[model samples]
Target: MPESPGLDELRVLAHPVRLRILSLLTGAAMSAAEAARELGETQANVSYHLRRLHEAGLLHVVEEVRIRGGLAKRYRHDPESGSRFMSTDPREGQLLLATMAEELKRRSEFRVQGKGGLTADAEMWVDRETWAKALAHAHELSELLHRAAKPPRTRGTIPVSTTVAMFEMRRP
Candidate 1:
């Protein structure tokens, strides 16, 4: 297991490209060239982000193999127990919030283009005990999903941002 990453490390990963690279590696090891092709980016650009991610300790070079008489680096995501969602750096937090705002704007643009827009589905809950248990167990469910992948491989990393927020309604 790797050591938990700190706020600085998280900030290094907060970049859109770096986060996508990590997501791609989470399924299996990949070479920078392959990652670049998958992301529709140039190899040089992919290599840059790959180096940053490795420097942050979020990714590690698992192996170097000979390909076409040249060495190719294979990288994998190495998430540790200390990998919390919180960031100590204010700029990091601000960047994340800004990213969210940008995404909302993008989604709105899609709606204007006739794309199926966003929708909110809500339900009322009265059983605090049950809801709390469900919230706690949801983490376990996510872990299970992460660990349970068939073939456990991917062609490329897709940039995906997820926010799972659970909050109770205010008392009347």
Candidate 2:
């Protein structure tokens, strides 16, 4: 298992399309064609991004099946693979956050209210103990969502979005 993504992997993940693809694969394995259809992207474009992610060790080939006399690889993302993003480079971090922001905007377009959800934004000083607890709680929530994720439009499953960014900021 990979502990963390390297610089090259971070670069690969800085693209909005790739980030969306990762999110899609987290719920289930999918072939490039399937992913392209779901995302409304060209299959060739999706395939290129998929290859980049696979080369960066962020995606795994879960299976291969015959389709139209050719083999199609199904790729999936393992949330437990310990591939969380952590970089000392400010530029890299900015790139990732920008990519995530783009994805958030895209997801917001499809937002449906009245079903109950969480929306939080904070950037204030906090006690050490409170910060520690918040981090733990955030991790727990993320794990819970990832574990409960199901394939797109799965029966009895509702589509949801979760985006969290928590870190201690340096005094400025």
Candidate 3:
């Protein structure tokens, strides 16, 4: 079987808090303190996770500035092409799967409390020749969407977080 890329980094990112942190900062940058406040967590707790993400190269310090007379550090997510996870062990795979489940739960819970349930529908077409073309098109479409969804030029802006989990398997 072909190995998934960035599996290890994905594992690190699978933590609910870490995933939340990334979602919170998507398309923009924020200070650790700001992230903590948005997540209803302590500054120290947010800092710890931010450090881990930075170490994994998933995030980086974008800027450091003084906000309201207090020195603060700002961060941005690292944009990388292809999968960043890098593990093959079954145990690690299980952990990655669990992390994804927890993240989904947290997001769903938040949505329910704020408004109601969210819904989405997807369709796929499968064929040896057409599948390759379709997959390539999807990749291009994703890049375009990412580029078009730029954050507004304002501070204290919270973005809507969306997670896309893709799994594909084939039998011969």
Candidate 4:
């Protein structure tokens, strides 16, 4: 496992393009060209983001495939880098929060646009122990889904976007 990234690294990871690139590489390996095509972005643009992620130690070159006598870098997301959700630096934290909000909105919008997608919200009160158990269960669920989505293995898959949150309802 990789240690958590530093504040600067988190800031770099918070860039929208970098986030999307990382997401694309998750559970799979891809070259910059492929990522660009998948994202409808220019090759140069995606390459820049890929380089930044590599420098930040968020990605690794898993293989190099020769295509037409030229080497193509195959990159995979580095799960060892730990969570990019928070940073010790205030500015980085702000950026992470903003990026997360934007991502939540984007995923929600995309899922709702299609048929038979889930978007749910609920408020619950529980003692600290029960809250901890609930949070633990959520983490377990995330791991299960992640393993199910692992590439180069799982077959016949449809992209699924899930957003789960549990919080105490603050009285306004």
Better of 2 and 3 by TM-score: 2
Quickly count the clashes in candidate 2: 0
Off by over 4 Å in 1: 1-8, 81-85, 88-90, 100-135, 149-172
lDDT per residue as tens, model 4, 1-172: 4444567667776777787777778768889898898878999999889898888778899999998899989888864453544334556666776886677777665564647865566675678898889888987877777555555335777667655645444566
The per-prediction CA RMSD against the true structure, in angstroms, equals 5.9, 2.1, 4.9, 3.9
Best by lDDT: 2
Q: What's the ranking of the predictions by TM-score, best on top?
A: 2, 4, 3, 1
Off by over 4 Å in 3: 1-10, 67-70, 86-90, 110-125, 137-145, 148-161, 170-172
Question: TM-score, each model?
Answer: 0.63, 0.92, 0.68, 0.76
Please, what are the lDDT tens digits per residue for candidate 1 over residues 26-109?
A: 667788888888767899999999998787667889899999999999898754521554554566666655655554554354
Give the higher-lDDT candidate: 1 or 2: 2
lDDT of 1: 0.64
Candidate 2's displacement at residue 123, Å, is 1.2
Q: Candidate 2 — which pairs collide?
A: none
lDDT of 3 by residue, 3-82 (tens): 56455556666688987776556566888887888889999999999898888777888899988998788888744522
C-alpha lDDT score of every prediction, in listed order? 0.64, 0.86, 0.68, 0.73
Model 2 per-residue lDDT at 22: 86
Best by TM-score: 2
- State, as a TM-score between 0 and 1, how close model 1 is to the true structure: 0.63
lDDT value, residue 4 of candidate 4: 49
